[model samples]
Target: MRDNQITKEFFDWIRQGNSGCIFAKLFVLRGGDTPWEASVIRAETFDAPTVEAIGETLKLASKRSEAIQLILPNIKTPEQIARMISCLCKNPNWYCTEIIPKPSEYTSSFLAGLRWKLPDAVNVNWVLGFADIETMPPTRRAPYTSLAIRLGQPGTAPSVAKDKPNEVRSRKKENGLVPVHLADMPTPFLKDDAIKKTWVLTEQTAGKMLNPTPEFRTNAHAKVTFALPMDLRDSLIGCFTPVAMDSKSEIGAEEY
Candidate 1:
């Protein structure tokens, strides 16, 4: 199927309120310098309200992270800065293929708080990126944290790419889902040539991307879940405006 057609189908699926369908939001950052850099700062499943709230947060965070990158000589790579922000944000869903740095005293507190806040059922797969074997964690533990390495050779690093939010938004509009992009919003962060964008995938689309073949069905009994860490939740809640609902009205209520 064509890319546009697939996007249309995804939008329709989201609109239909299909069971097991979730909206996966990805925050992508890219740079224009010679040694190119691109990284996904945050990726999480969002309910409608959380999506808008996160868009605003991403604008602020992107600017802040970039500024910190300029000041901190130790933070050279996008992945390094991303990891630092992940710790500060206490975002458990932060994905990185590189070796995550050992948390500093300040960041360690954030990491511990996040680990403590994790629900008993949620599992974290920790990938060690260090070249030295001695730095690796010795064992996996509960809340199901597993120590491992990212499989396969690392792919070529992502370079600065053109903004495609409009294309995605138009495709989504054709099938009835509202598409939100960081680029369209008014913010000081977008002044630079860096790439800022967000795209959502329905659970069905996410499944196809993860496991494209009919023969490779994921176990029906298996459960996979992700939770936002405490710090991020607190930060977003502070910024989010809650909509008031009438006690008597049962219709038009948002359910997560």
Candidate 2:
């Protein structure tokens, strides 16, 4: 099938409400070389019924031997993956999501090949997955996975946070002062001066940091400083920087 045709089918599937993860295959043929590339796209905002229709629609598309893949819902187990492969092989554009390196091999290949170049706040790697396969072509031998951080308005797709994996879940649940470099830090909305000479920030909590972004400081019209001895200020500033602010994030907002 053509690229435009696959896109049309994708949007149509969306209209029908089949949301979950989708596998996309793209094939380009020139001269004797036929390059096949496959990717995974999790439905950021489709419901179950809609996702079902998308699965069926994709099955039909694969039959045409086009460069597109559609991963239907309810195919979570290895057996299910086998069934999916059987169904997809009928399409001339067959490519495997699984490759040797390990659980993340295919996903790593996709990111390296595509180099998607996303924004700073959104992490896309967390959303990719791969299937188990027996053999793969040399060019296609590497495993492939695809994930994205949505940049559109929040309401468009329920928010990616709700679908984060357990690793992320653990990170969110982590409270207490986790030692972090001063340079690498999350937005610090919470901070306090335990002593005239010491400043403390909590990674486990939300809002209120001692030294917030320069913009926040200017906006709040508050004179802010490290509150450390003058001689130590420059050295502390270069350390992994944490933030301090006087506002609060909404309660339980981290869940989503």
Candidate 3:
């Protein structure tokens, strides 16, 4: 009964925008049937809100002697924090407010990366106030993260199309397969010569070319190619194909 009350309070605190870590520790020390299942808590939600939820969940699980290591800084962004809160909100059907802060150097690309995850149209409220900014805890995280190196030898190259990935049938899901080269919106104001030079050097270094033609660099960057199913490759490239530009100020930024 006491554990149930704690669980309810912990969730309440999160909805009220309280940081989850403080409560997380308390729950961890409780050591009983964790309010949450480890399988439900992703390795990714280790920061403020989610971390708190995780801590509570872990505490319960520890009682049963079935807990794992707590991964830190798992909270990546405010949206992720908000999403978790939204997910666990008592009003389970509440729609997320779409919030888009203008892109700036100070804003983490992490939030911008969440654009696709948001509901189609979101309401953006100014979440920061002058006093709030002064009282906010300092984040010790590095802006640039070093990607972990994958262990073990690379897999042997596949031999046939039967081994290929399934074909994408919808434009909506096709964005996931967008080719990496065309993933970023191409810069137009930049010189073509400079773009070509960089592309040539990169291709040569990566051994992407077998019997390269003079126009290969331009074509390679402009279109997509791969060893996968041709239909999948086409679907991927089509996602990034530039629509006609209507005005000088209308460059569509590719959502990474």
Candidate 4:
């Protein structure tokens, strides 16, 4: 499907008021390193009947993943990370989140504290591998002209003169620390020319893709079994087992 079509379908699916699990998978197509790699990182079973519930689920999943850290590594403070993630939750379009340094961190304790937060029937183990992505392409090296313009200007407060070499090195790091512009931020999943896309699928649609038949438990297990080094396939398969229904009889019994 076209990228725009997929995006619309995703939003529409999320708006449906069905009581079932929802799963989101992120896919990235790198230039030369790897053609494509994906991870099913977010899943929620909602009893509430509202589109907002779906948004809340995704926001919570994003928070649990610590997604801001993936895009901004220098933001070491926890409060800052929380605030940034909060902002993204409100306006995911105002800024973007990327998985930097690699995707392994998403699986490593990404769901550690989530057990108590989720409904008992909703299995957390269903999520595979960490959702973290490797580092954003390094900021393009700054130009010499820009460096000269920045260094030549004196600080707002009075300061003693330092050696040119030391002064230049310090200013270089300072200039590089400027926050990256939203437009300049690297696209994590698509080529430079390809259109970026996202999709949200209901559990049934996702299941069809991941586990089409009774024989296969999950699509991830079938397609990327080797990629999952944690070896949690058996546990994941167990989680997919259908919940049984109660067999209570409705007819009243007569007493002699």
TM-score of each: 0.18, 0.20, 0.19, 0.16
Question: What are the root-mean-square deviations of the candidates from the true structure over C-alphas?
Answer: 19.4, 23.4, 22.7, 26.0
Error of 3 at 201 (Å): 1.6
Q: List candidate 1 stretches off by more than 4 Å.
A: 1-227, 252-256
lDDT of 1 at 73: 20
TM-score winner = 2
For candidate 1, give the lDDT: 0.23
Shift in Å, residue 91, candidate 2: 30
Q: Which segments of candidate 3 are over 4 A away from where they belong?
A: 1-183, 206-256
The candidate, 1 or 3, that scores higher on lDDT is 3
Q: Tens digits of per-residue lDDT for model 4 on 167-242?
A: 2223211111211111111234433223221112332443454333322222122111112222332323322222
Sort the candidates on TM-score, descending order. 2, 3, 1, 4
Per residue, candidate 2 scores C-alpha lDDT tens digits across 157-214 of: 1112223223222332112211111111111221222211111112111123213432
The TM-score between candidate 3 and the true structure equals: 0.19
lDDT of each: 0.23, 0.23, 0.25, 0.22
